[model samples]
Target: MEKEKVVLAYSGGLDTSVILKWLENTYQYEVIAVCINVGQEEDFDAIQQKALSTGAIKSYVLDVTEEFITDYIYPTLKAGAVYEDDYLLGTSFARPLMAKKLVEIAENEGAVAIAHGATGKGNDQVRFEASVKALNPYIKLIAPWRIWDLKSREDCIEYALKNDIPIPVTKKDIYSRDNNIWHISHEGGNLEDPWNQHDDSIYKLSVSPENAPDTPAYVEIQFETGIPVAVDGVKYSPIELLTVLNEVAGAHGVGIIDIVENRLVGMKSRGVYETPGGTLLFEAHKTLEKLTLDRATMSFKKSVSEKYAQLVYDGLWFTPLKEALDQFVDSTQQCVTGAVKLKLFKGSCSAVASTSPYSLYSEDFATFGEDDVYNQQDAEGFINLFALPLTIRALMNHNKDQKNKTDKKVI
Candidate 1:
């Protein structure tokens, strides 16, 4: 009989490397490692070799950068989904796409089971499993953190050393990190203590605000239907645009966020995120929307954005509700074409100026000097009609209060 085949979502990182080896030795199963690249810095050939050397039957590396941006990142960006009004859903949104690829590879390899490195406590576990369940429910899912006796990262490290597994993290400098083109997140070190400030040495994406350049940098972003198409009049591919923006913004120390967020697993976890390019893009997009979108649409979209952010954070990306929300978001983006100039200073990305062909703002009507539209005399009747219900309610309440006082005096 052929050995039971399992496909592992390998990251070429410490946790996944150990999981890849452990699955093979523990269960006597054939493991095929699949590493999907989403623009994180890595040696792809080396990752493949590492997995194969660690007793994997085979390994595959897929470049999903374009698809990741167009399918997942852009839609989420258009929806303006920011979890807890801070996180840009960096890791939260990345998991579903990763899991989708895992399911696809498992089907291709004729694998009976799929394994992941996400721990039981983190949101990635839910995101990965939920995505698999939505895509292919028949495949058996193996989560080592839930079943294995490895209590912590330290325990995993010891196990790796015992089995001669080469891992990256060391005891002295141990920080759980996840990086991609869009953002880099740091956790599980000094971040565990909310009181401790983020160390300058740990930040790889951006400089510290204090050490940033004195002069501000400015860039003009061009958007079409809410998607950023150019920067400073230069048309760039999705990857190139983000890459250039990351360089420009990171140098200025923009997009650094440290927060203690409520995890999906009913616990709070502290995390530090650096999303330089994404921050600049979001700021530009938001500024353009303010100029183009109507007051009612903007107000309604705010509520939708909150719900969308929570759903994405909670790993409900593949569900129907998210799809429906995406349709509404797409509709709203129709008029969000514009150009926005942003001034990037130390730790800040502020909109300098914005202009949209579909802009609803009327300078003539808004001017203090003179306006052809919007009659000033119409305000009196409009105010009275709008306030009628409030006026009536107050008068009736006063009359009732007077009656109550007279009744008390009589008694």
Candidate 2:
């Protein structure tokens, strides 16, 4: 009899490394580690080496950074989806692409299951499994944290030590993190305490706002159909655009957020995220939309954006609602082409100026000076009709009060 082969999502991190060994040792399954690069910093060759050394029968490292931005990141950006009004949905969107790749690999290798090292308590477990299930209903999921004896990161570290496996973090310097092209998230350690003012050491992508250069930096971004195409007057590929913006914005401490968000798994978790380029892109996209999108359309899109964010956050990216919302968002983006100038200074990005061919703003019509087309009296009829319901309601109340007084006098 032969054991089944499993495709494991590997990162060369403590959790996945331990899980790779554990799957082989405990279940007798031939583990194949699949490392998909969505622009996180790591040597792919080293990750493959670690996977093979940790008892993986084979290791794969695929670079999917550009695909991640164009497919996952751009759609979310067009929808204007931001989880809880702050998180850039970097991890949220990344998981779906990773899961899609995992499914692809599993199908290719005829693997029995796809495994991940996401903890039972966190959102990643839901995100990974949800996306996997959505893409391939038949593929089984192997979540080690939910089933294994290793209950915590500390436990995993101890297990690694016992197994003589090389792990990245020790118990003293332990903080679970996820990184990608869009953003980097840090959880656990001092971040566990909500009141613990975020330590500067936890940040990797950005300097502290206080430590940022005293001088402000200005950046101009160009967009087409709500998608960022260039930064600082330079055209770039999707990867290059974000990469440049990340470096430029990070230096000025532009995008750092610390929040306690409600996880999909019914628990709250505190995380510190740095999303420099993403922040700049979002600001420019939104400001451009304001210049071009009609007032009614923008207002309705704001309401839809919340739901879109929730769907993405809850790992429902492959669902019908999200697809439909994407369609509507795409329709609205037709006019969202423009360039926006932003000032990045000490953790803030402010839209300084914007111009678009589709701009709805008409200075000629809005100007206070005497103009041929202007008729101030036109607003009187519009206001009267708009206030008609309120006026009728007040009159009705007045009549009711008069009737009550007459009845009282007769009594």
Candidate 3:
């Protein structure tokens, strides 16, 4: 008589393959599953043989794709974190690294509780139980779609057709996707209709800016202190430089979006996403941080990239203010090194040129055919010391309107 181990973050789909046989027929619990690849073009030996043919006394898959591109997509692409600025949080920082590898395989399988299949209406069940209560606050967490009786995806596809269990998904194209290598979202059927549009056969990883490639491609990239290794000049290693910029920006359709967001569980969903090579590495690291930041550190890193994209889209990735906003985004990526040069087209990508050897752009102090670093009459003593407080508030509103016109002629 022995049966009580849990673990499960499995993903052979159809809701963790019917929550791995509904957590062993509703709580007899022995499931072990894992599966934290992070690059999501799965097969992984058929999802670890369908998690040991759907009962999972044990089954992992852990590739961590170069520790998910050097610890969560290069510190959220060196903290230019996006989210509401159109999400590149990519499944919000890959569900806190798949809940820290399901609490490290439930503390190496002594497992007492860790299930997940994230669905009590989504934000990935608070990003997989707040990253397993911020990395093991004494494990125990199971979720079974917030306590199951299988109340939906068509009653868990009729309880995986009465537990014969080989599911993928049906009921005519159930969307709810979530791939990796940087992005692929989608979200429930007809993208939960915010005026239902999404259907160019739900374009997996791209191709539908009116069926792309009519021409226009460019693509240069390079970066360093701010990550991305190389593309055109060809260096590639962070997973072959994002798989050759997601196959040349998904053949020109360049990262699709389609938002409607706002869902830290307060609801307002409607997704779509795609992010072909994380939109050409976030437009070549924001055009090499506008040729190496500065303008008050690029306006205080745009409010620390919107509070680091709302604390990594609200999962709060192992806190302490996201480790002091990743040390202020690694001191603004040192000198954000550079290269840029983008183009893409069809769905438009832009940033068509940038250089940076710490460039603060100087074309000889921005010339209009001028010469000696100008002092054109020193701009009238710097516009009278920058309009000295608007000329002393317009001479104190003209001496309070001439003392109300000499007290209205002595009343």
Pairwise lDDT winner, candidates 1 and 2: 1
lDDT of candidate 2 over 1-411, digit per residue (tens): 987999999998887899998998888999999999999999899999999988998999999999999999999999999888988898999999999999998999889899998877888899999999999999999898888887776788899998989976444655778899999999988889999998898889999999999999999999988889888778999999999999999999989999999999898899999999999999988999888988899999998999999999999999999989999999999999989999988999999999999999999998888788878899999999999999999999999999999999999
Q: Report the poorest 10 consecutive residues by lDDT, candidate 2.
A: 167-176
Error of 2 at 306 (Å): 0.4
* TM-score, structure 2 vs. true: 0.97
Q: Is candidate 1 or candidate 3 better by TM-score?
A: 1
In model 1, the clashing pairs are none
- Give, for candidate 3, the lowest lDDT window spanning 10 residues: 167-176
What TM-score would you give candidate 3 relative to the actual structure? 0.37
TM-score of each: 0.96, 0.97, 0.37
Clashing pairs in 2: none
Candidate 3 regions off by >4 Å?
A: 1-7, 10-22, 25-32, 35-58, 70-72, 81-114, 117-125, 129-225, 228-291, 294-297, 311-355, 361-371, 381-389, 401-405, 408-411
Q: What is the number of residue pairs that collide in model 3? A: 0
Cα lDDT listed for each candidate: 0.92, 0.91, 0.84
Error of 2 at 391 (Å): 0.8
